[model samples]
Target: MKAKGRVLIIDDDAGIRDAAFQVLSREGYEVEMAGTAEEARRLVEEYEFDVILLDLKLPGVEGLELLQEIREEDPQAQVVVITAYGTVQVAVSAMKLGAADFLQKPFNPQELRLAVSRALEKKRLTLENIYLKRALAEKEGQVEFIGQSPAIRRVLEQAEMAAQTDSTVLLTGESGTGKGLLARLIHRMSPRAEGPFVAVDCGTLVPTLFESELFGHVRGAFTGATQHKIGKFELANGGTIFFDEIGNISLDIQAKLLKAVEEKEISPVGSHRLVRVDVRIIAATNKDLREEVRAGRFREDLYFRLHVISIQLPPLRERREDIPLLAEHFLKRYARKHCKPVEALSPEVLEAFLRYPWPGNVRELENTIERLVVFARKPVIGPEDLYFAGFEDQAPDLTLEEDLPLEEVEKRHVLRVLRACGGNKTLAAQKLGIDRKTLREKLKRWGVTP
Candidate 1:
């Protein structure tokens, strides 16, 4: 069985150390002991412990000084000081140096056990608080799934079933299809809901720091690594780790990540010891891994490892039945967020939205709604508002006439294509048979802001 927690006992007395070790071991904690300050320093550097028991009167070094050093290295360290009778003053000094708690000398087995348990509880709460803050900061307060369409219901069904097991999940969909939101939902439904849910954007990770970002590194591990850093995997221990845009990662990183996903172990960038992590992997990608593997762009083994259970999120156009619901959802959300009085979309506006092909998926729809809400001039958004928001259904007249300049013809055609694409610059560029950068340059020359 896995130990309840790891504990380190640092004391000079042989009998005291043995007694504490046996007591904690009987309670299912992995225990380690250090007789001297030097040995304790080495043990602390090599392993991560949940709680530490320190003797205030070591031979070579003052116990308070050692406590300070430990706390300096790891601000979250939980150390309980052991003081002889009548040495309460010295124990109080240790507390000022960051000791978590102090145990009186001639402590019984129950006292020792209680001190360790309290220290472990404090550490657990501290870590949860830190991870919770990070999780909230990473999100923009978006709700998960909001529609009752068959396409959406099927996805929710699959997700709910997947959440019951610890299997790896691969979420495949077009950009902005709520893959991240679905991942969060699965995490909340899983048994590890109390644990952290860490999301890593594989597409945005710097190649040079990718390994360190996922597995962490010790101090002095690199030129700028001034202090010990925890990685995403370690932070997500006992929870879920969501890798967004997994297809964008290189083959090299795929290879490095394979071992971690397969064995639940990671070796930090500069450490030789492999740390075990209990994380559920949920990877999202806009690309088909099968095609990537056939083209030799992705590793076959890694793809198989991550494809244990696949869930494909339907695009917005495929679930047109849910458009009204989604539009209203975003409308109310952004309306209240931007303090706009907009309450409804006109009939013509809703018709235009249904007729339009949402190439950018739900994300594009959300951005469009937010823009409209921010610039709304009345309680109900009308068809006229769509024109200003760039979702206008009417196409510009482009009849060729004599004496028209070539630049004028090109500009009108580009603008027409831009409007057809719902102001999605990337999609507009593709439709115009040009790169986004070139398209933007042309728009700038034409006195238009892209």
Candidate 2:
């Protein structure tokens, strides 16, 4: 069986170490015993432990000093100090030095396990608080949809109704059509609003590390895996896990994912034990999954499983009526973000925006508006400024030349977008509707420093 948690028992007394190891091992924890402070330090450097049992008196190094060192290495480390009888004051000193709790020297198996459990709980809570805080901060201002078009209203209606249920949702739209944003909105409005919203960018995931990235791995599971790590599915337990660009995942992964989606359980990379997860699956894909299934690129079973409820987001061009509102929205946001006095777009600029194909959709429009806001020397953006921003000239031309290799065309287009974004990689990636990592990888492959 997979251990419930990993633990380290450090004590100079072989008898006490053996007793504690037997007790914890029986309780289903992976227990390691260290007879000295040096041995304990070696183990600590090698693997991560959920809890550590440290005897207050050890050879060579003082227990309190070792405890301080351990805490220094990992401030979140949970250490339960063991002290001799009537040494409660010494234990109190250990606590002041970052020890989580204390165990009396004559502690029985029950007392030993209880202390470890409390320490593990404290560690879990501390990590959870940190994760939730970071998640919440990333989610600020991300849930709002900025369009009022009928097409948007329809999508919003479906999303609202879908949020109230636990059913899986498949969001289909062109790239940069706000599928991710809509997914966040659904999560925020759902019953699990308080739970974490974890998003996995399927397109950016390396095929080799995909499984471990999604399902986690145990310590020493594979090369460079030095510690047990939780995956996105587990991290999203009790909440939603959004699989962005889901159609990009390969067939082998699709097979493994199918079982998890069906069973709501995941097997970590090197473990036979299956972990049950309670996560609402919200999968977004720019690809036509139906076509992908027919083409044998996507699994039919997974497709049907993920398609319990479907919401299609209209691309920005299809909802051109909302372009003015969206433009204003992005303008105000970037104006405030860059501390610019730019407030609105000129009539000609808005007309040009309406006429552009916007292959990158809302994201492209947003980046263009932000660039205008940042570079605008006056209160209102005019056509003359659009010339400098290159929106009118560098807008991607979908038309392909017969002799131009697709790769060359792509390189030119990406470079153009990057130039238009003023060499801002983040803005360039957003304008191209790809993650910054993907953009960096592409640039690296193209012999460009990113």
Candidate 3:
């Protein structure tokens, strides 16, 4: 295997430095050693390393102080503390200060190698996540709103306008219509954009842990509550709190949440003092809260409080015009992510995109593009490269039914086949058992442009 990464060892003890150097070098790393923090700082200035292993009991510029200096120089740097068994507290402190890992003194060679490898892997993943986030931000302008239908355009307009407001916003949409993305856009564009935007999926939180997570808990509040904790609401005090799938939360939790929203204050589970906070709440649900309210499944008062401003996203079927744009965006993203050279989508592939009534919306489009990018052999994704075999059973109503007009049914079937194939036309015609030229004429007559 190729060399993984570089490692820097800073230790006052010559024996420990030599041992670390040998272990790390054997594990396919370019290893560097320093006898003091001053020397380590000089080496760091000269070159970047994937991991830094520092001894806490150094003679000069003791470990924690040097760790602070290293952080001040490069906040992204991964530093692992080397502590004695008795100095375990110091090691834990180092971890709180952003140290990647700790190695107790007199550790086995295998343990040292594993710790170094884990630290390097963590650093690598962190850098990769940062890069992915940057790329996602750059691509945001390409397909910010992923549909072309008038209904979708109206929804986009409402979303853009709602993003400018500080009032509580409610997003109602089908399960896969990209409600979460709209919520993120709202937070990103709002006045509190610089502040933290916390997202909590209410559907996933356990009933018992809900209050402590939302309103926080004082130390000794419950059996496992050993330390004071700041909850999601406090974390988003000056920013935005996104309550995803709010319809799934229980009535008991809703009552507590309602009080927090109305009073702008939250009392920790074990505390009498209420903490005042300013937070913008953004709630999302696939279920209609109006029906939920009448059914007594959701709080009526809380629904009105959250519905101060509302935006509804249209399904992908309503935005067929946006399919090509969304497909291209996802294609480019997945191609770059997987390091593939795949280029444009074929005409048939484009047709397939425009025909499918995407029940899963933009997410399904993205997944299909990623799948094609990974499996397609040609530089240009063709009709044959697009796959839609399973969608027939999965989407029964979307398949051409016997009651529909033959011409209209043919048009719908062709589009559905093409979309399932990622807009590939040749394969769509083959699936339809018609000539490519005939398919082209039918598409033209149907006013379907690839």
Candidate 4:
């Protein structure tokens, strides 16, 4: 898949603009150039850019002024200042104005590409981080999720299809498979891109406050209701409300949600008035909603409503071939973040990454890369660094813990290995230094079947 990013190059010099454009375009980036700060400002206003290369000196307005304007336009745009060798001070000043990084005037192709890559990587990570913060709250997030595998591409295709409609969408996947990221992407691609995006974690909401939190409440609605409160649906009016971990909500709340979803209207707690809302609904859950419905925990009506257009994100293990791409993306990100001199992961490190099952998925790998960058001893991270980064498969032996019986410990270790290897018994057995037959017997004793 092509990189989903645009780069803006603002330089008065024709040669510099052409050179930068050529380099970025060749790297699969949509490159736009501006001869002056005015043109650059227009483009910045017209389009969203993942990275902006701003020359320190422009013809009419100073580049620093343009940088400030760009920050004003979109504070999240990654602006990288371009300066002559002796003008390092000016570049430093640009950074204070929200410039992401600085590049020397005579920088080589490698430096230019690396700088742009790092900036774009940062942009991608920011999206995921924002998504996670809204959905999971105070959790680390994944970076660039580019993958050429047919599986991931299919998921993107499904997302694009879902984006074309105002119908309810249900995204199902393993945790860290980036369901929240996909939800935001769908919103951005939809007609409501300019509107607010309200994300609610059903699992995080208190059961007692679920109805009021989702449907708003009037003044004196309850003992604690001192004033009127606007809920998520009202906040997401004219936009989208992402119901993350949707299966965790109570059936009582599900009935209320179903009525509001169907009618596009809600009645506040202790209020007879019906408030209409024009909001798109996108629900996500790691749990199987079908199972929840069958178990009577989730309302079948609500499940049918949300299961309109479903997209299933493939787990990281199913697309191991994409590990290197993801790893390199995160490596550049955290390296630039911690101001580490690290450049890339060594081949051995990539091999180790591919070897690991990544049971915790993309979020696990992203966090590991950040930690590795902080403690990296060299410019290139190898297997030793990967091991130090805790990529090795070493779970605590339950037998060694206090009051743990040998049989219980063995069963727990087997289950742990099975989970780490993504339900592959052969691989789990190999990692445990046991044959498949022995692992099967051990698992059978734990009431697990192949």
Give the best candidate by lDDT. Answer: 2
Off by over 4 Å in 4: 1-145, 393-450
Best by TM-score: 1
TM per candidate: 0.83, 0.68, 0.57, 0.58
Tens digits of per-residue lDDT for model 3, 27-71: 788888999878988877555566888888888566788887776
Q: 1-450, model 1: which lDDT tens digit per residue? A: 978888889999999999999999999999999999999988776666779898888898987889987775555559998868537678678878888998988989999889999999998788777778787788657446888999999999999999999999999987678898999999989998878889998866798899999988877789999887778898898789999988878888888899899888887777664566789999998888999999998999999999999999998878988999999999999998888888999887788778655655687778778877877899999978877865563333323565866566567767777978889998886654344655675788789984
- True lDDT of residue 342, candidate 3: 89
lDDT per residue (tens digit) for residues 228-342 in model 4: 6667786676689999888878878888999999988787786664555778999998778888888889998889989899889988878998888888888898888899999
Which of the two, 2 or 4, has more lDDT?
Answer: 2
Model 3: residues >4 Å from true position, as ranges? 1-143, 388-399, 402-450
> How many clashes in each candidate?
0, 0, 13, 0
Q: Write the per-residue lDDT of candidate 2 for residues 1-450, one digit (tens) a residue.
A: 756787889998999988888889889998889998889887776555778888878878877899987875545559998868537678678879989998887888888878999998897687577567657766647567988889999999999999999999999987779999999999999999988788998987899999998988876679998866778887787789999999989999999999999887787787664566778999999778998999999999999999999999998868999999999999989999999988789998888788665657898788788878878999989988987776656644544566877567668878888987889999888767667766776799799874
Provide the overall lDDT of each model, using Cα atoms, as 2-decimal numbers.
Answer: 0.83, 0.83, 0.76, 0.77
Model 1 weakest 10-residue run by lDDT? 391-400
For residue 253, what is the lDDT in candidate 4? 85
Superior by TM-score: candidate 1 or candidate 2: 1
Error of 4 at 14 (Å): 70
